[model samples]
Target: MAENTAERIDWRQLWASGDLARFCFICLGILLHATNETMVATVMPAMVGDLSGVELVGWSLAVYEIGAIVAGAAAGRMTSYVALRTNMMGAALVYSAGALLCATAPSMPAFLAGRLVEGFGGGALVSLAFVSVERLFPQRIWPQLFGVISAVWGVAAFSGPLIGALMSEFLSWRWAFGVFAAGGVAAALACLAVLRGPAATRQRNDGAPLPPFPFATLACLAVSVVLIASAGVDVTPLRSSLLLAAGLFGIALFFGLDRRLPAGRLFPAKPLSLATPLGNGMIMVAAFSVATVTFTVYGPLLLTSLHGTSVLTTGYIIAAESIAWSVLSILVANTPPERERGIVLAGALMIAGGVAGFAYAVPAGNIPLILGCAILQGGGFGIAWPFVTRIIVTAAPAAERTVASSAVPTMQRIGYAVGAASCGIVANASGFAGGLSSQTAAGVAAWLFLAFLPLGVLGCLAAWRLPANSASPAPA
Candidate 1:
């Protein structure tokens, strides 16, 4: 127990002794990762038009997601067997190389290869990043440090696209990739001095054998390919069905491997076991609720096709949701626990409302209404995330905390993948017409599909199962 305590040290001393400068740089790396993901979404349409690879547009994002999920899952295991410094540095190097490929790639295949590499690097960085809080801080201070980390995400959510837009408009979309590469290199070097200082690797005995890599990678790849392929309407139903079947089969096989891993490992022991029901339920709520943010795709398409708005205007409108989400997140960190639950539940309801508000958008023909609905939805996202995240990380037994922490991202990735695919199907079936559809039909679909979000209200009810006394004290 003493040794275990040493490994998962409490939060107070860790925070006090933590190198703040290191935190700043690490947050910057996180910001860059978020930026790359959002920016690519904004710029990819333009890039596809320019590169004439319209057919491959969906694959660009899908491939990156595939790489990231595999990397994140693998990183959890690697953390058990490797020095923290080695994992951090290795991921940085790999990510940087991937970014370089993206910047210089002359063909669609090459760019995809680059995205794949970057995904691995980005995945590893994110999966292990929160563990640093565990390593550096004691338990009492975990919530506070986690709040700081959450703030970084809020900032990245808003700024990434704006930055990407400027890069795409004034310079070239290629510059977006180039800038990330430079940032990745600088982050790697900074960590080398502060994090990877010598002596540890030379002493031997990192941890244990890494789980066999083959099945995990294959399963992830299959899932990503199927999801991406489904986005194209041209694929025959027969082919799509086959791909979907193969992907599901692969995922089933991966889980079989997951069961063979040790305790306090694989899929966050707490969530998997239903030990932290409130946290686990809320994370699942987040999965369904947050999907509404993707409605931004409708914003641009609406502006350009229906309202005759320019690209710049569309960009600002799309950015409003992110900005709203960012600002509300900070406010949430400071909220009291009783207030936090109410606020989070309210947020889920609001997300549902905002999604339903999509129906109002077309009838009113009011852009401001659309924006207002987005902000309301964004606020819900902002409030719910921090509280749920706090609960999940802190609620578990110390021995299982690492696995618990890991489940948050794992659930998020799987959720996002499923959400994107499912939403695409919903939008298509409802006659969304890409971005050019009449507001009336799009609004109805948005409302109907969003009905799934309020279903998350069920999570709030489940929170009751948590010990009545089990609540965090008011935020300082």
Candidate 2:
């Protein structure tokens, strides 16, 4: 069968639609979040160089995602009462303010506060962007739309890391955050100008009234992440273990409560199980996402310490994955539905391979091998992500499409949040907190890089469960 209606959909019409301006802003919202993530990674080594809390390196990422998870959970519910344009405008402004806070932070603890705030605004922007896609665009081109969304990261890959590298290498890293802060403000202004009409200002009744916001469910996730993240920051083996166990319970409680929500449920039914299509797809995203944080949260420090790579070089090296992902997603956006299953399985294997390669290549200090693995890991995700997403949204119950769409990124962030905390624990245990000597750096490289390999295996196992029958498009 034809793939996701893209072959029959008009590519030009998407750009020509009257909604183009809204669409552009949507992309801008995505750009802010994507750039902020990679840019921070590029600048992290420098941030630590000038500051303390090397042991808390993972907390930087953890706090950001924690903020994101909260905002993302609330974003869908916000749409029931808040206008899309208004929600977006408020979110963009908040994002800018948070960046400004980060840019001026005086110490590590202070900087983390900024990251948390920035994450809230950025997360809402992204989740709202997905809701906007469904609300504004023709259903015919959803696959194509997702392909373009994937390309946004590639754009960020070039711009975000470069800005970060430049700031870290030449000027102060604070300048990088300053530039993005300005970008966020610009996006907020565009929302006012482009979405001016009375029709755009009102809440859109896209479907039946959504349920009341799931406060109990949201609390479970918040508590879970806090306990898990706190466990690693001051790592005593016994205390950390206890916290980790408590955090896992939070996740369990979240799943239990979220499942019971009548209409305002955070996910489709059976979100955690692999039996249902939505669950299986979410599992795949979560596993691979958890498996990949080594590069983002820890890649720069290890590269600089092990090989004497400049910040710019490390940024570019990590940026390679983004490049590959964008190219592959664009290249394969139209694969017939029949082939999607095989592609998913193959891509899962490739992702695991690249992650495994990192454990060896990082410790060995081989530049070519490291770059090659990065490309493989990125390309694997690019190749598989759209199809995985398509399977998910396509399989969603007609009434719950919005929830399913927003859940896509929310699920991915959950993986990153858990992964970041796990990284702090492993890295600290490996003696990185004592500061890295060449000998210790190599050992940390081995442990840190290998830590998430099991997540890769788990993702591959989930990939095997993807239905062989082709799924259909979601309701328009």
Candidate 3:
């Protein structure tokens, strides 16, 4: 089937159709966005030194994430009302403004403010990129497109640190932020060129607007606060208790919203529907959950701690995963959708194995082992993400596609925050290699935390629920 499509649409035809160019532009934007994220982690300390807001470092990242989270649904709703090109341009403008703010920040408070604003734009842009694929491309090519997107991350991981380091060393840490701003400008220009004209500015009327503050704003607020409290800085009993209470309140509110809202208005269709593919959902959760911990925190820490690897090396290591993920993604994209479940299940197992290997190999202090584990994990990630995404896209109705797609990144961010917090708590308690007499304890804890990959076996079960008898896509 894939062979037929490949033969029919040659590269020239694909390019001529505009899908290829659109993907390229969006991918390039995402690639730069990704690079900024990884690069900044390496040069963050320098920023702190210059800015003297070491305590607010967590807030900088956290606030950005918070802004991004809030903007996800908003973007979806806007897409329904506005033209794709207009929506993208607006987001780019917001992002550019935020970047400029970051570049000029004179204090912790100011920098944090910049992150919050940037998050608003960044979140929308990222999710919209995926939504664009659904809106602009053929269903048959999603897996391949997703792989290509994943590869951008790999490329970013490989190159971001070097760019960040060079800018930081020769220029200043401020240059990191400046570089991101420049990238945003470049992407905005590309978008303007490729997606221009008055027709590009009109909003479609395919569906109703999403509910105001869908999924309960309180719930999202709580989760954000708890995540920040947990990962950001020192936790006192009072602060922890407050955060816990807020998080609980948020969770309760979300469930209430889920139950009370109508189908068209709800964030998740049915939170407690037993008939839903529980196994697949859990596996998906695990795959993303592991990603949150490993990539969000542990991977970066590994570079800064044991090997004293520079920002450049850290980027390269992360790039290794990106490369593996992209390669596997392209391979799986060509496979029949019927085989997607089995492929995903196999990928889950591989991811688990790789994580386990990393844990065992870490104690030996072999860099090769770590790199191998990253590659393995990347492959697993490559497989699971697109398959699960395909499931959601194929299952949901066209009108509800944006809402459903929003869940992917929402869950990913939630998983990442939870994973990073959990790992941070454990790693802090266990301490680093040289700091402790028995590095085994911390290493064991670290591996155990990352080994969350095996739990994705449940996703295999979810794949079983995909209707086997029907060739048509699932109802929205």
lDDT of each: 0.61, 0.83, 0.62
The most accurate candidate by lDDT is 2
The C-alpha stretches of model 1 lying farther than 4 A from their native spots are 1-18, 52-58, 76-86, 105-110, 131-148, 199-233, 245-264, 268-283, 286-290, 296-302, 305-308, 334-341, 359-365, 390-401, 423-476
Q: What is the lDDT of residue 402 in candidate 2?
A: 69
TM-score of 1: 0.75
**Models sorted by lDDT, best on top:** 2, 3, 1
Listed per candidate, the RMSD to the true structure in angstroms reads 6.3, 3.4, 5.2
Backbone clash count, each prediction separately: 8, 0, 6
Question: How big is the positional error of residue 342 in model 3, measured in Å on the Cα after superposition?
Answer: 4.3
> lDDT tens digits, residues 138-163, model 1?
46656655666777776777777677
Among all windows of ten consecutive residues in candidate 1, which has the lowest summed lDDT? 196-205
lDDT of 3 by residue, 107-169 (tens): 868887887788788777876787778777788778768867766776776677667666766
Task: Score residue 424 of candidate 2 by CA lDDT.
Answer: 84
Scored by TM-score, the top model is 2
Instruction: Give residue 176's error in model 3 in angstroms.
Output: 2.2
What TM-score fits each model? 0.75, 0.90, 0.75
